[model samples]
Target: MKRPEDIAEQFQEAWNSHEMTALAALFCADASFVNRFGHYVRGVQEIVALHAPIHETIYSDSTMQNEVISTIALGDDAAVLHCWSRLNIGKAHPAGPHSVDTVILAVLRLLPNGWRIQALENVTLTNPRTGQPVLRT
Candidate 1:
């Protein structure tokens, strides 16, 4: 199967399950992840550690869906993918559920075992109303 397709499936399954081990498996040993807020986490072990807390708290009730925008193959052993995802992290804050829209650029390496994310950067798009309506005192 194509790398994008495989990763998408893996993402959906692992994210929906909110399982640390499963999510970490998709990344290469030296992978890195930058969350929407620019929180940088590197290495598979760190990735697992970072996700564990969120999955148990703010992201516990969340669901994620990825939309692949493009995939560029680098010869036969690497590929770059640009994709976006809608994270229903509605319960994370007391403000109520606000689905987050995030864009991700992932570099994948085709290893003997299959494709794994070498690095993934995510940036969240703030809603137009973000920091708007200067609150009353």
Candidate 2:
């Protein structure tokens, strides 16, 4: 059984290393990703495709940190995790990295590929830039 801490660590590693491929591989074939900006993507293919461009341009020096708040095991095949994420978008601004807060809720299913992410949703924090709604690309 993979603990929430382990899952959180893996997520952190993926973000820190900017390992989009590895990160996508951690999802189930039909996994769903709901980014901070409320963009929802389903399946590994879409997830991978969508991340390619964003990973290329964004987060040039960003670091993602997630703190697990709770985990609820659902039966023997599924679990739900609630967490908070603080993203430090790197020093492109005069003020240096800006902090963005978010709440993430994810569903994980035990699969042959291990504990893959089945679904995810996020409640985003305010975007300091533009003062308008920040949409995840």
Candidate 3:
């Protein structure tokens, strides 16, 4: 099995590329992902269907960097990830930072195939009205 850092980096790389198919390949068949927008997608099929179009259109050129704050093994085949990420939507360098603060708590399950993300809950760290950063619950 790959290290958690390696697995996470693969996910980030897939997302940064906006390749939904590749991203979907990292999930378990019945995986679920909840976004900061309060939307929940169930299963890899739904995840690919619902999750990719937005990134494909809006974040095609965006770059994402994530800091894995921590990871705790729930058992031999499962674990959780707490991470913080910033998305740079354009290539205009640091000044063009339309930073989207995020906190992701993901549940990963080892499958016969490989390490796959079973579930993920993503939340935004910002004030919706003013667009100022705020702590999420």
Candidate 4:
């Protein structure tokens, strides 16, 4: 099983590469997700469905910068992870639609495949940018 610390970078890498399949694989079948917009959904299928469109739009050219704030074990099969990330919207550059310090709390379980995320909830720590929400290419 991959340790929580080891798999953290994979998530950001998957997002940066825009590989939906790789991104979804990080979660278990019953996994749940809550995006930055505050919308919540259950099941890995739903999580991927919700992300697909967004990744094709605002998050299409985004890259993730993850920082693991903490990790606590829950028994033998699960662990709770708290982290923060900056979704560098569009090509990296000077101030634009900065994704104000997003925070995430995820529950991961030791599944047959690997350590898969079971439930992940995220919140935008601050409001969206005033005029621009994302930089264009």
The candidate scoring highest on TM-score is 1
Evaluate residue 15 in candidate 2 and report its C-alpha lDDT on the 0 to 100 scale. 77
With candidate 2 superimposed using the best TM-score fit, by how many Å does residue 13's alpha carbon deviate from the native? 0.8
Where model 2 places Cα greater than 4 Å from the true spot, the runs are: 92-96, 126-137
Candidate 1 deviant stretches above 4 angstroms:
127-137
Q: Higher lDDT: candidate 2 or 4?
A: 4
Error of 4 at 50 (Å): 0.6
Global CA lDDT of candidate 1, please?
A: 0.80
Instruction: Give one clash count per candidate, in the order shown.
Output: 1, 0, 0, 0
For residues 47-137, could you state the per-residue lDDT of candidate 4 as single tens digits?
A: 8899888788777777888888899999878899888777777644344555545778888998777788988887766426663333222
TM-score for every candidate vs. truth?
Answer: 0.86, 0.82, 0.84, 0.83
Tell me the whole-model lDDT of each prediction, alpha carbons only: 0.80, 0.76, 0.78, 0.78
Spell out the clash pairs found in candidate 3.
none
Model 3 per-residue lDDT tens digits across residues 82-101: 89877667644344546676
Expressed as tens digits, the lDDT of each residue in 73-98 for candidate 2 is: 99777889888888888775345767
- Deviation in Å, model 3, residue 96 alpha carbon: 8.2
Ranking by lDDT: 1, 3, 4, 2
Error of 2 at 11 (Å): 1.2
Candidate 3 ranges beyond 4 A from true positions: 91-97, 127-131, 134-137
